[model samples]
Target: MDTKGIEQMLSVLRSTATQASGNVQESGPANAGGVDFAQVLQNSIDKVNQTQKQADQMAEKLAAGDTSQNLHEVMIALQTASVSFQEMVQVRNKLVTAYQDVMNMQV
Candidate 1:
């Protein structure tokens, strides 16, 4: 499974948190060396949604007895979509946890 997106998100979160804690100077762009977190998150979600849509189309075509749609290919697409979605959920959980932790921190 591809994890580059998740890694980038985590890296950005760490760097941002460090900067918040006054370890890094805020003289330039907040996320100077990385992509925007919101963009990365949206792209990841879009990718998952696209995969799910493709898998649904493949499954429907297979059900309709389309000769071009192979059963294995449809199954693989479904599995890929499922895995990507699960990964997204996990990332969301982590983000929520981090947010809660930040909220609980002392000023």
Candidate 2:
């Protein structure tokens, strides 16, 4: 229904992630930019969460017998959201583990 909303959300998350990772320069004299990893990660996570929310809504609609949409479309959206959430979780876990490992290293 709201495909454009999804596209915008995805783009925001991408730009945010790029900025957070210090890959994109925000400050440039003429036309260059850089990304800050923190901001990027935050934005990406927010977008992913929003996507998950949308998926949840779709699922709800389907469950309520509002069969206006195809089941495959709903399922695909749900799966995509699930995978994104899981991937983000794994990334967090890895970051935490690396941090712990570094903390335990010899000074």
Candidate 3:
């Protein structure tokens, strides 16, 4: 991947993190229209799913000898999808660990 693509991805991650934190802070007892944690998680998963789908389509097109598709772009997309999936898995593992720890805590 090029520096520009990496920078763009970092910017997107930063914005998403900021938005998630902002939503958490704003979702107090008085905020009736606050975002739900489940919804946020679902949205993130959906985005990752979409990225993976796009990558898959690009790979398929390339394999079918599509002249319009660039090899570098297809590779980048595949890598991005793979990294996103790994990150999501890590997040899920952390969440599960946290939940288990909370459950095991003595009240």
Candidate 4:
């Protein structure tokens, strides 16, 4: 459990939320800033994947008699990964529903 890494991740999410709400202004196009919506989404998914992998590894290590890793930390990591994944799924569902609604709209 890297506190610095967790803080950095949280900051990224906060900035992304602010940007999405139009509270933050970019000097150029999203791609130019290297922070477009697609990129942000991809980064988030990647982070979630990394977290899941880390959690899995930690669990394995703990199971293998690794005394450095604590059960509480491993459990927290697992729960965080699970919640992040669930949130990503919900976002995908919302996107799908929005797309369907748009398609069903009468011109």
Candidate lDDT values, in order: 0.88, 0.70, 0.72, 0.72
Better of 1 and 3 by TM-score: 1
Off by over 4 Å in 4: 1-35
Clashes (backbone N, CA, C under 3 Å), per candidate, total 0, 17, 0, 0
TM-score of 3: 0.71
Q: Weakest 10 consecutive residues, lDDT, candidate 1?
A: 25-34
> What TM-score goes with each of the models?
0.88, 0.64, 0.71, 0.67
lDDT of 1 by residue, 1-107 (tens): 66787888888898778976779865568546657899888888888899999999999999999999999999999999999999899999999998998889888
lDDT of 4 by residue, 1-107 (tens): 33443444445556755765569865567637443555656676787899999999999999999999999999999998898888778767866775576578666
Candidate 2 C-alpha lDDT tens digits along 5-93: 33443465566457555698545564354444567567668878998998999989999999796799999999989888887787678
Better of 1 and 4 by lDDT: 1
- Worst window of 10 by summed lDDT in candidate 4: 1-10
lDDT of 3: 0.72
Order the candidates by TM-score, highest first: 1, 3, 4, 2
Best by the lDDT measure: 1
TM-score of 2: 0.64
Estimate, for each residue in 1-107, the C-alpha lDDT of model 3 and write its tens digit: 22333344345445445654455445457756544566666767787899999999999999999999999999999999999888778767866775676578666
Cα deviation at 94, candidate 2, in Å, is: 1.1
Better model by TM-score, 2 or 4?
4
